[model samples]
Target: MSQVLIESLSATIVDLPTIRPHKLAMHTMQQQTLVIIRVRCSDGVEGIGEATTIGGLAYGNESPESIKTNLDAHFAPLLVGQDAANINAAMLRLDKVIKGNTFAKSGVESALLDAQGKRLGLPVSELLGGRVRDSLEVAWTLASGDTARDIAEAEQMLDIRRHRIFKLKIGANPVDHDLKHVIAIKKALGERASVRVDVNQYWDESQALRACQVLGDNGIDLIEQPISRINRAGQVRLNQRSPAPIMADESIESVEDAFSLAAEGAASIFALKIAKNGGPRAVLRTAQIAEAAGIALYGGTMLEGAIGTLASAHAFITLKQLTWATELFGPLLLTEEIVTEPLLYRDFALHVPRTPGLGLSLDEERLARFARH
Candidate 1:
């Protein structure tokens, strides 16, 4: 057995244009910015990772610029001479010095895992408790804001068998307006597709109280973070009464948050994101907590690019149960990808790679084209 020591760490920020404006309650996104991480090992292996946020700071605490700066000024320095194969130990080292830069830590941890996978000649999933499935059913977000356009887009996805589950981005508009938009799309798609809504925490308790019932009665499958994460009592009330299953996205940011939400009966479904929990391993710990407390799981995305998406997939594929599938169609939203071998999406699922590492290689040329100079 040989030790793979970390030689150098570098981060690149790339700007990618989305296929369309991704509208959320907090913000509207015309482009996605990512902090791509590169970890070079003494054993001559290089691994890739990504740190991305939706709508910049509007979605979470960490932004692309902040992630890049922290990685260089803080995290990378600590990691430069550490054991790349000892991911847990390396993460603990970073945690000792840094606080609450989950996205940055996630990127670093992902690169470490990727390097370990490549060195071991096994896929990242095998390293993360071994994968139970090879493919994951992915859900698409219908954020066009236009009812007609959203229905058309969902129909095309269904027609091509690329996606059968659709999530709608609501709460930016008036509650009645958003409900009308969702109802129209659901009626048009009918039994052809499953429709869900993510409010992004735009409603108050009273607003959500009305919206949840209306959405559920209209056949919506789920409602995500309708009210604020701080309003635990409101969340508990909504969870107890809403006909549709309540999913906590913004609320459950860590393992402690998960346990607290479970104890309070705040939500029935947990939207799991690696970056939110600091890394793949941390998110897995959160998932275990959810499973133990009888909470269902849905793999959530921070609208990450290829590197982060595949890192998430490698960990998620190893989960025991994914009741709500995953909303990992983040890369598909971008007009271009930084991966040499683009992810395979067909038959309503994203196929996992059997190759080593995160099962991805960087397309340097494409990355350069999108790189922020």
Candidate 2:
């Protein structure tokens, strides 16, 4: 008789146009495509997860198609016979047996946890060492490009009671010019809020210094990825001199990167994304590194739908020290949701779902409507 054999793993690309346009230095969009991966055990237990492919391939070096194909053609084969519950063993095997594609690896990892949790009738957060916060404080994004338009967007979010923290996108314009725009938005919001900025690899060290000085004076809470991600010299330079605590976004992708960043005193904050860091356990390890170093851990998003959003939410819930506000407002950015019960947000807070597994239920109807092909 055949043993528990490797079965099938599959992916779907769901194109969800944002209900409102979300702007970043790389691109502006009213829509996003999520690479949703589903893996099954031979006995029919299944799990679902998401990988976000940003910027249509040109901007972020990834796409939904690439993430899905990597999972189906490369990663899934390695997991076919492996025990689904042994995530540590699975990850070790993944490193030895497969190559590096962190985003793709993360997508499959999420699915595995989803399957494992469902089998035990537990939420993924429980498996991650239980939860600390059932709800997360969310930040609203100030649209990029136009300063006045961004402030208007911020005001709109405030009117709707949708957010308490505001993240401004800075990078398309020169550093000084960008600060002018940033100042305009921050001033518009007045004394009632906190502001942060994501440079998105748009500035150099000198510019980072000047801009951070101005934003810091204007009450900016932090400066995210002030300089280019790949510039170690710049990371060190900015981390040492910048007035605002520097946060790593485009940089710090792996445990090695996390160790390097902390060892070199590259930044005061670590921004962890499940998609970029690869999976929950991987990000958690990174979190432990940050905590040991007395650094702040901030959860980031990739503008994902419910699947990826909830996956990150589960991880964030279990984290012992997520000291900074989170940007897990992907569902809010989308025009619609594909979850049966949406992650509830009130007073700028998002409640972690209490359901079992990754704690999300997909709406098949929405999937049918959004699938590009």
Candidate 3:
């Protein structure tokens, strides 16, 4: 048998409309742009992945254009002649040269894993190491920015049995105002839903001190990235003071960050994101650090589409314990999909496919229509 070499790598920028204006702390997402990655092997197998961010560069360091550019110029050249089945070697090669393009690296790593899984006739979960669960409980983010509207949306999701965990996006408005909004929504939902808030590193430590107390007192389940990621000491202090457990989101830009955050006791829970940690295998390294450190885990998302969502899902399913559940509802937030069949979300959980690769196929016509020329 001959070694299957990577033939070509390509990336396409696709813009998809969202179900609504997803209001985050930094920016309002009117649409989501995905850098769809395709890696072709010498054996004629092509694997797909996605590198998506929120509100262009508002949420993360890399945007769709930058991701595509780097994938084309930097990543493709290095990966084109490498062994497609050797994900470890390929990823290490990228890390040795690339500095901090985790988003793009994640896409490339996912494509490689997808290709290997397809070639071996195994799911990405099994490729990672066998899955412990076939489905993950998905959390819904209520970012409508209206208390009543968010409550109504939660009720609708609950009514349909789609989601019972609701995470509110706060810190955009005044602390008191955001508190009132969260309290009102929590009051409306009461014990029927688990309410949480993601401050997105908007609030300072001073504001977070009081806000965290109020949220924890009012039945809020969690508080995510209350303070800035740069203020490591502040995060540590807030983690000790806050009544609700603090989850590190932006604080973790890489697996090393996860280890450092764990060592410093900055957060009790770690938000595991594939884009932030590099890729599926890389994110698992972070998960292992959290487990070793006795920190809980919550599967986070960058609001990716079907391909990215399933890729993340495949990695998440292999975990032994995901205490805080996952917010892998990115695909649901989008009004359109480029895949032939959308992912299945039922009974408040996203079901992982047992099929090979990411268990998804691109809709070429839809992809062409949505691709940004």
Best by lDDT: 3
Pairs clashing within candidate 1:
none
| Decoy 1 TM-score against native | 0.99
What C-alpha lDDT do the candidate models reach, one value each?
A: 0.92, 0.81, 0.94
| RMSD, every candidate, angstroms | 0.9, 2.0, 0.6
- Using TM-score as the measure, name the better of candidate 2 and candidate 3: 3
Please give the TM-score that candidate 3 achieves against the real structure.
Answer: 0.99
User: What's the C-alpha lDDT at position 87 in model 2?
Assistant: 75
Please estimate how well model 1 matches the true structure, expressed as its whole-model Cα lDDT: 0.92
lDDT of 1 by residue, 213-295 (tens): 99999999999999999999999999999999999999977778988999889999999999999889889988998898999
Worst ten-residue run, lDDT, model 3?
Answer: 51-60
Model 2 compared with the native: what TM-score? 0.95
Q: Write the per-residue lDDT of candidate 3 for residues 119-142, one digit (tens) a residue.
A: 999999999999999999999999
- After superposition, candidate 1 runs with Cα above 4 Å error: none
